[model samples]
Target: MSVLPLVFTSGWASGINAYAVVLLLGVFGATGLADEVPESLQRTDVLVVAGLLFLCEAVADKIPYVDSAWDTVHTVVRPVAGAVVAALLAGTSGSLPELAAGAVGGSTALMSHLVKAGTRMAVNTSPEPFSNVGVSVAEDLGVAGVITLAVFHPVAAAVVAGSLLLLGMVILVFLASRIRRFLRRRAQRREERSLAGAGRHRPHG
Candidate 1:
């Protein structure tokens, strides 16, 4: 089968958790489970870095505002990883070109990342952190499951990934207001803290 489907699946998964996708692909390649995986991805150093980052994300993703902060930091990281991985996959597969693969992966990842970030923004509005944990766990599972399936059944995994991406986009559009509110509240908090700090440092009579 063409590697394009796996590229799409990995790109979608990367938007949710880039490290997980990279780590899993590295392992799959190292273990000889999927021959289409690029040799560069299977390197020891790559796996180590990806594994550590994945662990960090596993923890940070369950937090509330922290997850948003982490997402903010990853806004560029995830899409870039997706593009690089897709290009590598395409380079080895010999059908799809690297530039095309990179474009597809990067764009897909950016859209999915926006959806994930926006959804988390809305979810963090909840009073309790339980919902955040639940959502994070679901995302981790979804990424892992789909990526694994992509190894064995790329087309099927791509279909599932596309469906989930569409669903996430729809939910994000519906929750646009809540996400905006979340942003406003965060900004308010920062401004308040800044004012309080200024007050503390003000000259005394």
Candidate 2:
């Protein structure tokens, strides 16, 4: 197997949820579901770490502002993880060059990461909690489904992943203005609240 399709698909998944991708790939590879996964990724230590991180991410991802902060911290982490995973898969495949695989994986991860971060920022502008939770759950499911399909049908999974990336980009572009307006209103409300609180504490002349 070339591992190219897997590289592309995993990269896309990694951007949205690197820890989940790691956990899924490690579990699948360990259980004989994916043969192209490298031995390094299948180690017990790696799986344990990935599992814990994924658990933490799954919870934090549903929170409103917290998720945006988390995304800021992981702007670099996701793409690097994607490149490393791609390089490892390339090593196992033997047919693909490791550097080339890493580049493809890293670039795809970067693009998807941007999309995820942008969407989350837009979503955070909303005061309701349900939308954030809904989006987070959908991302988790999408990552899991894509990874599972990549193991058996890499090409098809890659196509699906690509389509999703395009759709996300379009949505982000269309909603940019609304996101900005929502954020401004939220900030103004917060400032007013702070001013009101200060006024209440002032001494009467």
Clash count of each predicted structure = 0, 0
Clashing pairs in 1: none
Clashes of 1: 0
Task: List model 1 lDDT by residue over 1-205, tens digit each.
Answer: 5889998998999899999999999999999999999999999999999999899999999999999999999999999989999999999999999999999898889889999999999998899999999999999999999999999999999999999999999999899999999999999999999999999999999
- Per-residue alpha-carbon lDDT of model 2 for 1-205, expressed as tens digits? 6789999999999999999998999999999988888888889999999999999998899998788779889999999999999999999999889999999998899999999988988888787988999999999999999999999999999999999999999998988986687568668978999999999999999
Give lDDT: candidate 2, residue 1: 60
lDDT for 107 (candidate 1): 84
Q: Each model's TM-score, in the order given?
A: 0.98, 0.89
Q: Which ten residues in a row have the lowest lDDT in candidate 1?
A: 1-10
lDDT of all predictions: 0.95, 0.91
- Please report the TM-score between candidate 1 and the true structure: 0.98
Among the numbered candidates, top TM-score falls to 1
